[model samples]
Target: MFTRIRMVVLATNAEGSPDLFLTTVDATGTQYEHGRHYDMALPRARDEGYETPMIAFDQYDAAARMLRRAATFIEGGDAATGN
Candidate 1:
């Protein structure tokens, strides 16, 4: 069966800081796997002379784990799925 895969990019900026970008690719297929990339620089922000934003990989990994857990719940998994 063909499952739907979706890519989501999240960007954030502090009040006085540059914008940070993150991208996640999620697969809604049988096994449910995901891939993510973080710390991507925003060209516009750079072009306008804004400092390049930074994202800690540890933080991104934690967030990605949380998102995966949420996805498991959204899929209606039980204790058997370790969700």
Candidate 2:
């Protein structure tokens, strides 16, 4: 059977909130996905999910940023490993 599941948060972005990524998955082997390796960053990355003064990182590494944000950022899930 196919499943309609919510998008899982991959990681906190350079911005202070969850990086906005969504997907529709065909869990069963009957259907095939159309896209591969799709990535989007706006004309400029923008703050999301919260308007308050949340802390953001300036680092290039996502995992390193997450580690630095340990006290400040709320992790989405384990997918932040960039796996």
lDDT of 1 by residue, 1-83 (tens): 44433322233454555343433333334434323222222343344444433332323455556667767777887523645
Indicate the worst ten consecutive residues by lDDT in candidate 2.
35-44
In model 2, the clashing pairs are: none
Worst 10 residues of 1 by lDDT: 33-42
**Predictions in order: lDDT:** 0.41, 0.34
Question: Pick by lDDT: which candidate is best?
Answer: 1
TM-score of each: 0.30, 0.22
Candidate 2 residue runs with Cα over 4 Å from true position: 29-83
True-structure RMSD for candidate 1: 10.0
